[model samples]
Target: MRRLLGRRDFRTIFIALTVSMLAESVLVLALGVWVKDLTGSDGLAGATFLALSAPMLVAPLAGWVVDRIPRRAIFVALNVVTAGLLLPLLTVRHAADLWIVYTVAVGYGLSYIVLGATVSALVPELVPADLLPDANSALQTVKQALRLLGPLIGAGLFSLLGGAKLALACAVCFLVAGVMGTLLRSGRQAVRMPTTSDRPTWSSEVSAGLRHLVREPALRTVAVCSALSMIGLGVGESLYFAYVDQGLGRDAAFLGILVSAQGVGGVAGGVASALVVRRLGEVGAVAVGIGLFALGSLALVQPALWLALPASVLIGMGLPVSMVGTNTLLQRRTPAHLLGRAATALDALVSGPQALAIGLGAVLVGVVDYRLLFGAIGVAMAFVGGTLWFARRVAQPAVSTEPAPAQADFPG
Candidate 1:
């Protein structure tokens, strides 16, 4: 961890990523609260998440774009463009302007996909392959830590100022992130520069990520499980507002407490992730994470503050554990050239179902009991964990064809 922090480029990229994620976290929470305040409907609040996540369905194309350009340029340009796009949200004043908010959410989601792929592709260039797990964990830790403050600040700001002001503030944060990204200094030799000659057609480029993901057994298994886990996540997203309003008898600002509690779990999970991976291997760790998350969601079925608070913490811990393990697995198995597309492929798979699930849950929340919704989510995640366990018996270790450079301290 100390050695990874010593690298200048890693530090720059980490700071940029942290700042951008902090702002994004705040913006997402704020948007949810804003929509709920305007409409007083759980379904509408969930719709905001649906719009934010729906663009992930196009992540393969976004991934191809990430690979096609110089990553540093992609990183800088995305933040700058996202900031400009968010500026239009300042004019959103009434229910009629909600369409603009949803539009911006889609744009935000698309940029997130592209920038996320760029980050994955850029990490190997910035740090030694051996340090990948620790580096990835550190980034997750920082992002999670910010959750403690981001949600509280966002909710408070939204209450104090309006949504328009919050949107402007989030836009400024993106501008700062863009400036920070430009400070990163990865050498051309370290980065796999995309060539124009013999470039595949657009469709081929889009499918390239999917084919590569399908070819790797471990990667494929993890991607499937993660997608399943995301369905459970969507259930929670739709019902969270109702849970806070009815279960906890609180206003939007109280989301800060739940988010901060989750951050506590995230910190522990991030710190313990490498050790977990070392002991259980990536596949086993993912199963454990899914199980833990399922247990946490089941806990949420109880409406008491004591149970819900701890449940949030459990959820926080479980999610990061799953994500870190899966991410390390992908980085370890994927070739350098395919990293961007592979990351996006996984993104699309995981987030696509989640987006749809959010919409479904949103509708369900209006008609069904929130407790029943949570129970169904918990059962689904447990089933996925069981499926992974059963499949583990039949799954063979993938043959290692990685170049020698990637073999060093690879976490596979």
Candidate 2:
């Protein structure tokens, strides 16, 4: 991990990523607060999140843009575009201007897709193959760290400066991140778009990532189950606040306690991810992480704050571990050229379902009991774990028949 961080390119990208993610965390919380204040409706506030996530459905198409453009350009463009889009928030003094928030949320969502694909494609170019796991682990740790502080910082700033000023602050963060991204050392050429007259149409281009994802057996299984996990995440996203307020008879402030506990777990899991992947292999580690997450979800059915706190820790740990394992697996399995598309495809698969699930959860939470929803989410996660485990067992014979890579074996 130390060696991975010592490399100049990786270090630069990591610093830029950390700044951008922290800004995103602040922006997300402030946007929610902004929407809630304007409309005084939980449903509308939640709808803001939906707008932010809904553009993930377009990720495959965005992947084409990522691959077609130079990665550094995309990275810089994302921050600049976001900064520009967010400037309109200063004009939003009345409820009539709420559309600007949703519009910007969609832009934010699209920016996530573009940035996610660009970064995934750039990592291999910036670091050695052997260091991929450690690099991903370090990045995950940064994200977890932000989870602990970003919301609190954003909420505090919103209280002090009001939403318009808070939006300006986040926009400044993006501008700084864009400048930092410009300092990254240029590497390989991004995948070029075919200009042949017979080139594939737009729809075919959009589906390219999905096709690649489905063709790789290991990636296919991980992508499918990860999509399931995202669905569970969507359910939790809508219900968790209500669970804290209504189910536990606590104020909304208690949600931060759960988030903090989860951040603690995420940090621990991210620090341990490389070791876990080395011991379990990517597939086995993912299965274990999924099971752990399921166990945590099941525990959420408990009404006690103490129980919920620990359960959130389990959830936080499980998600990042599984994510790192899956990401490493994708990187190892995919060719260098297709990395951008594959990453975006995975994003499209996972985030699209998650977005839909978030919408469904919003509606369902109004009708269903929070405990029952938690139970259902737990069951879905367990099902995903079982499915992956079963697939692994069945594919054992075929695994040996598959040709091994020319490089040294992974430390499984």
Top TM-score prediction, candidate number: 2
Residues forming the 10-long window of minimal summed lDDT in candidate 1: 403-412
Give all TM-scores, in the order shown: 0.81, 0.86
Q: Model 2, range 193-304, lDDT digits (tens) per residue? A: 6779878887877777778789888889989898898899887889988889887999998887888999999998898887777676677668777887898889988888
lDDT of 1 by residue, 279-329 (tens): 776777688789888988899888888898889888888877888778877
- In model 2, the runs with Cα more than 4 Å from the true position are 193-198, 237-253, 359-376, 390-412
Compared with the true structure, all predictions reach lDDT values of: 0.80, 0.81
Off by over 4 Å in 1: 32-48, 90-102, 159-165, 187-200, 236-260, 298-307, 359-380, 386-412
> What's the distance in Å from true for residue 240, model 1?
5.9
Residue 159, model 1: Cα distance from true site in angstroms: 4.1
In model 2, what lDDT does residue 227 have? 88
RMSD of 1: 4.8
Q: Provide the lDDT at 155 for model 2.
A: 88
